[model samples]
Target chain A: MKLASATLMLSAARVEAERLGVIVCVSVVDAAGYPVAFLRMDGLALGCIDVCIKKARTAALFHMDSADFARVACPGGGAYSLELTNGGLTSFGGGLAVRDRNGVVVGGIGVSGASTEDDIAIGLVGLAALS
Target chain B: MKLASATLMLSAARVEAERLGVIVCVSVVDAAGYPVAFLRMDGLALGCIDVCIKKARTAALFHMDSADFARVACPGGGAYSLELTNGGLTSFGGGLAVRDRNGVVVGGIGVSGASTEDDIAIGLVGLAALS
Candidate 1:
């Protein structure tokens, strides 16, 4: 995805975050799991910055929302301990893969610095901006 | 620095990288060494993603260019073996601290995936954009 487009998506996500009254760190990564864009709002938790980017990387690499991947990475699941691989993955909510109109995966977005549900909401807002 | 400004810097750096015929991974970190932005050009070496971020983090935390810090981290230098600390620093080239007009450090930028000199040049392009 083009960097300009990624910036627009980040802007939209930030608006949603403001509406939700939560500051956040957001990350965008291309389909190959390479970072395309990232933003950390002022006053955000420093640790969540890495988590946000890792979540986006995880979503892009796996081509699935991080929340869904959490199930697959759970105990007795096929990909247990997968988070330990590939630098580190976030298997919980808040990461979503971005796909083009033809449904081809283009990138992924991850949000952090809030409750998991709110983070997921913010991530969806970013995904919406792509479509 | 704001994410929009960081994106502008990344865009400018990408233009310079294209002119140089090199693809690179770029990262921006806040004053506290927290990641604020990151990008990897298409076809860039995957290994450089983490390296670029680490370089930016090192620059932000140390308040100096990675190339300059290399001398300090050299054997018998004041900060020898410093690279082994703080999640691993990049003492070579391609990382630079970002300061405001008042000369207050606000962030840092790092570039990787090319020769050390080229990386440093690209990093300067990004820094110039921030000014």
Candidate 2:
């Protein structure tokens, strides 16, 4: 369960975004829901900050990726949103869970800019590379 | 940019876990940082819910995806966690942003019960399928 360092995570994300043709903001946190790294691309909306954090928390806490929970949530799926106690929680695009070589629940990734799928795509590619 | 639905996301995560032979939890959020779907595999810690939520938040907000950001930030990388006002944000693993057919951030995905990387992978695969 070894986690990648914040430095590598940010740099890789930047590189990946460049390849993907998207300017993205990324955030990383530890297993305890603490921040480890944060990077934002220029010319992005300030609102992205909030979106990124909640995405990270969902990955960290659930031990699951946020994207999975998001599809079946809300009233149609029984509204798990209210079930969660985390007020700062989010179910948006551009987040992913990070793991170490040891397969431990290490950190997370959050992205902004472009579309949600693009955010996820860039994020997955970066994580895959790091892994 | 189409995000996977909860049914497919969960089923795939479940199938992947079966192949991996591990128990896990998963979650998903929407573009607006809200819940879209959620699932808890048996034999998981209750606290994982919080971690997953925060992780998802990081991805959703930053738009860089979760894993990438988890690698950076904190006392070492300049506390981007506190920089954002979102309270439920996490920098952990197991979450990702989901998109629509048009590349809009329609929702998110999350997973648990295993390594964050595995979680990310499962989420990515599911999202990829939907895309």
Candidate 3:
């Protein structure tokens, strides 16, 4: 994905976090899990920095919402222990695959620093700005 | 620094890389050495991914260009072996500090995948876009 589009999505998530009165870290990664853009609200928890990046990477690498990956990564599931791969991944809510209009995966976005539901909501807001 | 500003700088470096016909990676890190933004041109070498980030982190952590840090990190210099600390650092050209109008350091930018001189030039273009 172009850097312009990546920044657009990142800004949208930041706006949503502001609207919800939450400070968060948001990360965008290309299809190969390389960073495209990232931003952390001032005063955010430092530990959330790596988590957000890993979340977006997980989505981009797996081509699935992190929550879905979470389900499949359970003890008896097909991808069990997969989160421990690819440098580390966050198989949970708040990370979603980014696809072009044709439904081809292009990148992924991840949000952190809020409740899991809130983080997912924020990520959705970012994805909605893709156009 | 604001995400808007970070993206602006990142775009400037990317534009420079395009003009030079070099597939490169660029990274921006805040004063605390946390990532603010990053971009890797399509088909860029994977090895440069971490190098660019480390270069930016070196500048941010030391408040000097990575080239200058290289001198200080030489065998008998005061900072010798410092690169092994703080995760890892790249003490070489292509990394420079980001400063505000007051000349206070705010962040840093790093570029990789080209000659050291070309990388530094690209990073300078990025820093020039800060205003």
Could you tell me which residue pairs clash in candidate 1? none
Residue lDDT tens for model 3, B1-131: 77888899999999999999998999999988899999999999899989999898888766789998798553334333344445567878999989899987788899999999999999999999987
Candidate achieving the largest DockQ: 2
- Itemize residue pairs with steric clashes in candidate 3: none
DockQ of all candidate complexes: 0.02, 0.08, 0.02
Worst 10 residues of 2 chain A by lDDT: A74-83
Question: Backbone collision count in every prediction?
Answer: 0, 138, 0
What is candidate 1's lDDT per residue for A1-131, written digit by digit as tens?
A: 78987897899999999999998989998898888899988766454676688778778888899888777665455877675567667767788988888988888898877777899999988888766
DockQ of 1: 0.02
Residues B1-131, candidate 1, lDDT per residue (tens digit)? Answer: 78987898788889999999999989988888888888899999899998898888778766678888688554434333345445567889999888889877688899999999999999899988876
Assess chain B of each prediction and give its TM-score: 0.95, 0.81, 0.96
Q: Return the TM-scores of chain A for each candidate in numbered order.
A: 0.95, 0.85, 0.96
Winning candidate number (TM-score): 1
lDDT of 2 by residue, B1-131 (tens): 12346677777777787788777666667666676666767656445665565555556666656655544532244554442347644445566777666766666676655666777777776666574
Q: In angstroms, give how far residue A96 of model 1 lies from its true place.
A: 0.5
